[model samples]
Target: MPAPYQPAGVSVGDVPGVAQTAPRPPLREDLNGLRGVAIALVVVFHVWMGRVSGGVDVFLVLTGFFFTASLIRTAQSGGSLNPFTRIGRVLRRLGPPLVLVLVGVAVATALLLPRTRWVDIANQVVSGVFFYANWELAWTSQDYLAADPSVSPLQHLWSVAVQFQFYLVAIVVVFGLAGVLRRSRGVHRASPPPHVYLVLFAGASLVSFVYAADGTSRLQSWNYYDTGARLWEILLGGAVAALFAARHPRPTHERRSSEFRTGRTALAVLGLAAVVACGFLLDGVNEFPGPWALFPVLATIALIAAGPDTSVGHLLRSRFGLWLGSIAFPLYLWHWPLLIFTLAYSGKPSADLATGAAIIAASVVLAMATVRLVEKPLQAPGGSIPRIAITATAAVLAAALVCGSAGWNFYIQRSVSDLQASDELDPFTYPGARELTDGATAPDADVVPALFSAPEDLPVTSVEGCIADFETRDAISCEYGDLSASRTIALAGSSHAEHWVTALDMLGRDRGFRVVTFLKMGCPLTLGTMPMLGESEYPDCLDWTQTVMSEVEQLGPDYVFTTSTRPREGGQGDYTPDFYVNVWNELTSYGIPILAMRDTPWLVKDGVVYRAIDCLADGGSAMSCGMPRGAALDPINPTLASSFRLPTVRPLDLTSALCDGPICPAVVGNVLVYRDEHHLTATYVRTLTSELGREIAASTGWW
Candidate 1:
């Protein structure tokens, strides 16, 4: 969360123990120390507590404050707002450290990470280097704050991305504001200059905050990384900075009284305490970049407003404080990747206390080295750093980083497209689920979705408009498998239901039945408050479910296909919940028969969930990479245990087709079982065509 987009004049002396002749303006050292403290919270909480520490929010505030204040001061001093100069200054300062991190991460990714993760990491590196990582993550809905997500080393760069984007907008705003101010200077002699800019920023902040507050509850994962949602935090910081710079030092002639100093100290103490306490008190992942973010924003403002005379400043200006601030940015860059790589190496989700300590220590050392080798060289006087030349050099580095990954991704896109187009697997080579269900054997062959091609391997429902996204209630439908066939099977539910559509589609085509998909991303027609796919606000999900069910009922399909039972949370058993039964009973009341299958196993080990391809690329054997069958499913089918099983609500569990007698391997019969944590790959699902076909005929007699 710590970003290096600081005020341009941060000299070598600002780093701890470095000597300088020129003294700093007020609060610079204090803000720097705050940066250090924020990064400390981020690293410690990320490595050990596995929770957001509100430190990223703090960085957002500081970054806005520093950049805006610096820009204004430049304007006040009659410096030109030349776009090239502004860009050059930012690039010259930021480019080296960023490139260094990218290059290092690229090398580490190739050497240390599984090949299944390489393309993703490459995407991350390119996005991080180009300063759009936040948007990339937002669009993908990568749960940034999940306890054990597919951890990326560059994930923290989202803050940097947001900040960099803010800088670009701020530059354009400043240019426009300067022209307006120059024209109105004499006309507005009665009023202060900052009021216009304040109104502008305040308006923008209010609009952004409104959108963020509404968005956070509906689609929190996207809202978390959305620049529009997050811009208010940075804008408010800029607003505060503008007010301070225009107002200038509050009459330096005034003496500091003892009571005033005590109040300032109390205020500073309270602010610091509030900032540190925020993460422990609030769920930052779900509640942040919204109204709750004000806690940290106000807390940071309080820290800045406390003034240099307070003991807080005395403390921040101390040796250790400066040292911490010096390495904050690099420490943030190093820590997450180290923590993730450590987890991958150990095959554990969280780090032990000893591992946490070592990661922190190594990060600090690397941060220090970066400061000396990269940052210090850029700042050193004799480096003769030509701003434009370095900007061009940095631009070249960024372009190279982008193109390298882009080329690889281009090849992947072309290759994956061809593979998808020619997707029929030879039954003898890729038996997949058939091996589990029918003891099908195949000639020895590699996995159908090669490690590089596996991540993109997904079901037919992946196409846009096939299913409603988490934020929308539109009953988006897509038809597959003999669209003209008279007998229709309505596929309704969440992605768990969607994954099975591939097999159903294959069955529908071969057997002259139509498959109509009415799906939502994570909503599985639950009417009660229970966690599904780690999401929230079931009201919206409930609404979407009702809409989809109504659409299916109106269509009056011969049978409705959905997932009947889910693997119970925090246990080694799958079960039909009262919520799912609510949906089933409702459908049955309308005289529609339900053909529901048991959910697939979510492969987890040592607290780390395994995506099938990643497991294989991590050097895990097919048998070894899988969870035991007993770990995810009950001895007796849990649907049979459900008290609400109406006779019309037929349960068609195919656990045998998804798992072997004792185990569900990540790979089966030379094909990857899952594309991600639990979604069956289209490649794998295709292999289940015969198995699903036979089951459907027995359940609905449609075949």
Candidate 2:
């Protein structure tokens, strides 16, 4: 059987569009046209979508084209492929401007950002400079996205990281193959065809792309930003280059041939249409660089094949196109930081027409100057001076990143401690903490019960395990409550459950109840759901919850308590309130009472977490450091409250547990309420035991 698709093959001594009879080679206007369109598409898309610019796809294709073209030329002339020389050339060309922008961004960040945000900015600077920003992003996504006013200035470098890594891998693969081919010249020409390299790379890229498409809904938090998961985009471009170089094109002189003007025009129109489609159709929340990405990639490939003699090619090769192409690199460099910074500082994200215009204009001017003065000089033959200057500058930038982080840490220690001293609320006298921990406050009693100390052994019934679920524990091995205990209570949810451990353990011991915790990070207990950060169907969440419920139902728990809301954007939108209702309905079906605790306030206003000390140090008044109770619980979930009409469910408002009359105090009763956002600290939870103990014993009539 014939293969699925035959890739373009490498044929020696075939230059597609150069007139065979001509003496001096003219510029490939067609290639320049391709560059112009690609860059323009990228700029337009980024300015609008705040999404990945398909322009990156264009750049990838161009990289493959140029790199392959150079290698083929060198190979035909019987010259050795030198990886070091190539890398040196790339560095000399791309490094100076990159270093300057990085340094400038660091300087700007240091001057503008608050102390609370310094560590993140410093780490991002290091990651961006080292070409590992993608990994940094992936790591952060585990906790949160850069959806804050304090987002790093260097976030745009994720693309650069992807490109740099791709270059390294491509160099090794291509050079290794070239060396082998030369050695085996005596054996056979067609033994392992040169085109196979491109074919294999393309096949792998397509597979990964499909994986990315399918994986987005499931692993958007982790794999969305991971370099390993994103490698396919870069590989796709490289594969295109290899395939194109491998092909021996038809003679261009004959007008009636398939490669003539009419054919080229048809392809160019299709390509342009694809570009327009991407610009209009692609948006945030769509699965990207997956199947939907074919519009941009196929369009780019089409334009590349439409030779310079065509009308569209000629237009693309014109002065305007070339000028935009010239500044494309710097344009891309400056646009994101400019937009992100503007949004960060403005305090309001509503984009105005004038501001957007100003940003675009400023970006253009900056790109023009950088390309003309900075990029051009470094890319020139005797660019050694600029390279040295850039190296010195980058070293300064690296030092600044380190010093800024350390200095911010020092500032937090000095200033926050001074402010902390002013907080004179007595720990022993505060009724909330005192009453909650009254019975369990003794340091002598083992606060944490033996059963709830570690993860519980939840039973699993399915053959499909949690391989696709990276952080989810198998139910078979992770159970929580002991059925033998007369008073059985289960803690189940996300880290919210983990945060309540100290209080729960204390309550369990004092009340003589078994506190079983069924928890996973980001994976809250629901009637139905999958693990938050992986591909496995969260049949486990439902399964685990169902099993726990069965156990709880059989044993007849006094109360099944869990936090039901988190402080998010505008202090609203908790995980599916409907699901919470279903869970309540399920518990009531088994005659079990439910006590749903309202979520604690996050310290930072905009959903980003900040160290309490850092917040106090950064000129933020005590009020701004944490959400006020009214602000934190503005839009309450009435749906959850409605379930309490069943008489078996109750809403245990912990709003007062960590809050004053109106303000949700960051610290309560002289103790820090949280180690991070939304989760009570183990230390603080100990303090809450007294108040919680009194309330639970009184409310449930267990006294």
Q: State every prediction's TM-score relative to the real structure.
A: 0.92, 0.78
| Residue-wise C-alpha lDDT for candidate 1, range 1-703, written one tens digit per residue | 5424232222211221223222334447887888889889999889899888999888888887877776665545445556566765666666677777787778777777787787888898888877899988877677876445367878878887888888888777865577567667743212236666677777898899999999876778888899999999989888887777656565544436667778889999989898899889988877888799999989998998886667887787677888888888888878887787777677677888998899899989988997776665565443466534544566787788888899888877886887687777788888788787888897788777876777677787885458888877878889998989999889988889988887888788889988898888888877655544454454568778778878877998888888888877777778888888888788888888888788988888755676777778877888887879888888877776543448777678777887776988878888888878888878888888888878878877765
What's the true lDDT of residue 66 in model 2? 57
Candidate 2, residue 538: Cα displacement in angstroms equals 7.7
Highest lDDT: give the candidate number: 1
Candidate 1 error regions (>4 Å): 1-27, 146-149, 181-192, 248-255, 381-397, 528-535, 642-644
Candidate 2: worst-modelled 10 consecutive residues by lDDT: 3-12
**Poorest stretch of ten by lDDT in candidate 1:** 9-18
Q: Candidate 2 lDDT, tens digit per residue, 584-681?
A: 88888877777776666665555444555445445554356666666556545543555546676665555556665577655444444554445565
Task: Quote the RMSD, in angstroms, for model 1.
Answer: 4.3
lDDT of 1 at 526: 72
User: Scored by Cα lDDT, where does model 2 land?
Assistant: 0.58
